[model samples]
Target: MRELERYYRVLELEPGASLDEVNQAYKDLAFVWHPDRMPQDNQRLKDKAVSKLQQINEARDKLRSHKARLHVPSTRAASQSASNPTSQQTTTSKTTSRQAYSSQSRTPQEPSYQPPKPHPDLTGKDYSGANLTNRDFSGRNMSYANLKGANLSDTFMHKVNLFGADLSEANLFRANLLLADLREANLQSANLIGADLSGADLRGADLRGARVMIGDRVQVKLIGALLNGAIMPDGSIHE
Candidate 1:
């Protein structure tokens, strides 16, 4: 498995290295294997790297604890550390101390860390009334999809494919939709106030009753879009 090979490469010792050597090797290998330093798109590789790091940590723990010193000590140590009451107590105490120190040394945890979901490949699929506010759907293929009444406020959809999509009554307030393909899309009554539509294709698209402004000055200036029946920024209705 890739996991086994990664662990072996990280330790740099033969397949039967002592736990002490593995720990020392981990200290050296961590510099290059740290997940934060790795490329973002290589998440699976970084996860494997982290798993190997954990194995090194387990190897060191087994050696120090004087438990069974098998060739693959990490696997056995983890099981023992989990099942043994003394080891569990020691682990709990250390964790509690670390937590107390961390509380003082670090800032409080942020409320929640729900990462933005990746855009679904829903090209030509009907997604009417979908609540996708403040989501990043940039540069995705969503052409010919029915997105009527969708809440897409403040969404980042730059250079996305939206040709012939039904975006009628959709909330696109302050959205960054620059260079997007929206030809023949039904944008009638769509709330596009403050949305950036620079270089976007809107030929034959319905702009009837669409709100295209925010305040006295246009928050999002439409560079090359239709203005038929759309509300202008200066409160003057576009004919």
Candidate 2:
């Protein structure tokens, strides 16, 4: 039981979480700790990420196996019931009666479908390699969008929702990203020189190999930003 609890903690999940919750947590952690999102030159951080990923995978696998084992007895009982001719006859009779009752109570109705209206939510959009410099995207919901290798130099993205977005190798030079929701964003090797990230929520964001500093000084502004669990530009995990 202690071992199982440890697995749940590794995945940031509560004990006794359902299988669906386990799968979701696994996917979220895997994406955050993926080697491709880490700096290739930082061997120490890369190794750490690998180890973390291994732990996450093991936790997910063990929990899945445990859940499967728990359902084995129910499965066996279901198979046994299916093999019993009398049980199958009784189940068929009940199912047929229910179906007949449902059909009798059913009434035909006209379709009331309406076409979906367009919205500004840009979740999961692919804008790779696009030149979007000097654009204003304030307060926009662009979560999980693919902006890899895009040129966003000098863009205004204040309060934009970039959660889980892939900005790897993108050019964000001098961009205004104040108060942006950038949690879990992959910013590996992205150019953040002269960018204003003050008040941004960067929790769990991967900034490995990102250019946020010049010489011994950080060129980008990170004042008032939330950096908990975020990998810094130099591949150091923020405490």
Candidate achieving the largest lDDT: 2
How well does candidate 2 match the true structure, expressed as C-alpha RMSD? 14.4
Candidate 2 Cα errors over 4 Å, as ranges: 1-119
Candidate 1 Cα outliers beyond 4 Å, as residue runs: 1-120, 214-219, 224-239
Clash totals, every prediction: 0, 0
> What would the TM-scores of all predictions be?
0.45, 0.51
How does residue 223 of candidate 1 score in lDDT?
67
lDDT agreement with native, every candidate: 0.67, 0.83
lDDT of 2 by residue, 1-239 (tens): 99999999999999999998998787667656855445657898889999999999999999988876665322343344345445446766866655655454443442223434655789999999999986667678999999999999977787899999999999999887878999999999999998878789999999999987788888887877899999987788999
Task: Look at candidate 1 and tell me the lDDT of residue 214.
Answer: 53
lDDT of 2: 0.83
TM-score result, candidate 2: 0.51
lDDT of 1 by residue, 163-216 (tens): 889998999987777778877778888888778787677766777777865555
